[model samples]
Target: MKKSGLISVVAFIVSVIVTASSLFTASGDPFPGPVMIAICIILPIIGLLAALISNKGALKFIGFTGNLLILLLSVVVPAVSTLFWNQP
Candidate 1:
């Protein structure tokens, strides 16, 4: 995979670990939850974009735009969810 792909993958894995850790534990810890939510929402979309850009031709642009849409939707949908989730 390319650099961007590698970054996206790492970001995604980190996001997952953060999410699991955050979920199992209670609030009032040193770290914040929104940041983790942001990571989880953004990284896979980034990975998709990176993979699309690396493609030879044809649907590269389309794939990027599609991923962007996914990104936007992911952000919008989860923005509220994390807020409620982190709270009791």
Candidate 2:
């Protein structure tokens, strides 16, 4: 696999694990909705900035991985939140 592909896969897997575990933990509201949203939004931007700043392949991998993880978290967290919130 290319570096980018490897990074993306690792990021996806990590994000899935983190997101799943987070869903089970509760503190009053259970979901830290806005915080998750901000992370999702900010990570990609930071990744892009890293990509722009670095000339090394490893840095590129890191940025891509970060972006991928953020994207996965963005989708999974909201979906999970909706499912739990809407349950009857």
Question: Please, what is the whole-model Cα lDDT of each candidate in the order they appear?
Answer: 0.55, 0.55
Local lDDT at 87 for model 2: 58
Model 1 steric clash pairs:
none
Question: After superposition, which runs of candidate 2 have C-alpha atoms over 4 Å from their true positions?
Answer: 1-31, 72-88
Per-residue lDDT tens digits for candidate 1, residues 1-88, read: 3455445445555555655565578663225666655665666576566755564443444444544554555566677778789756
Residue 22 local lDDT, model 2: 64
lDDT by residue for model 2 over 12-66, one digit each (tens)? 4454455556656675323487755444455355555545555557656666666
Question: Compared to the true structure, candidate 2 yields what TM-score?
Answer: 0.43
Every model: Cα RMSD to truth = 6.7, 7.0
Give the Å error, residue 76, model 1.
10
Q: Count the backbone clashes (under 3 Å) in each candidate.
A: 0, 0
Candidate 2 C-alpha error for residue 42, in Å: 1.8
Residue 22 of candidate 1: its Cα lDDT? 57
